[model samples]
Target: MIVGGQLVDEPSATSPGTFVSVDNGVPLSATNPAGSGDWTGWSITRSLIDGLPALFARNAATGALY
Candidate 1:
């Protein structure tokens, strides 16, 4: 799916990828959440946000990321 003009692919469950849900609407994420590997917080991406897996749920009424 396309968010914030960026491209994201829900290729698989084990490798569902990553995404950031901004309260005000900004998107940044990974293509593989499970294999995101080691990190040191040097990345300038959004933190404390829910990342959707290949199999995810969304609220239809508000289009909220759940």
Candidate 2:
């Protein structure tokens, strides 16, 4: 899981090195799935949006939530 814009492993996450978006706010073009190619993220820093800290990304292929 990518929490707070930093990759983190969930307590019961069965798969490793996998990530998905917990919220549906992320756009379709913003994602880079791991299996699609590799090296999905870079300079993934957290930024403020509408005076709120928000960071969103995901692999639409997974269709699973952690």
User: TM-scores of all models?
Assistant: 0.18, 0.25
> So what's the TM-score on candidate 1?
0.18
Residue pairs that clash (backbone atoms under 3 angstroms), model 2 = none
Question: Candidate 2 on 12-57: residue-level lDDT in tens?
Answer: 3357844443453333333343435432443333569999986644
Runs off by more than 4 Å, candidate 2: 1-6, 9-41, 56-66
The lDDT of model 1 is 0.35
lDDT of 1 by residue, 1-66 (tens): 444333243233343464333333433353323233221222223334366423443333344342
Clash pairs (backbone) in predicted model 1: 17-31, 17-32, 18-30
Off by over 4 Å in 1: 1-53
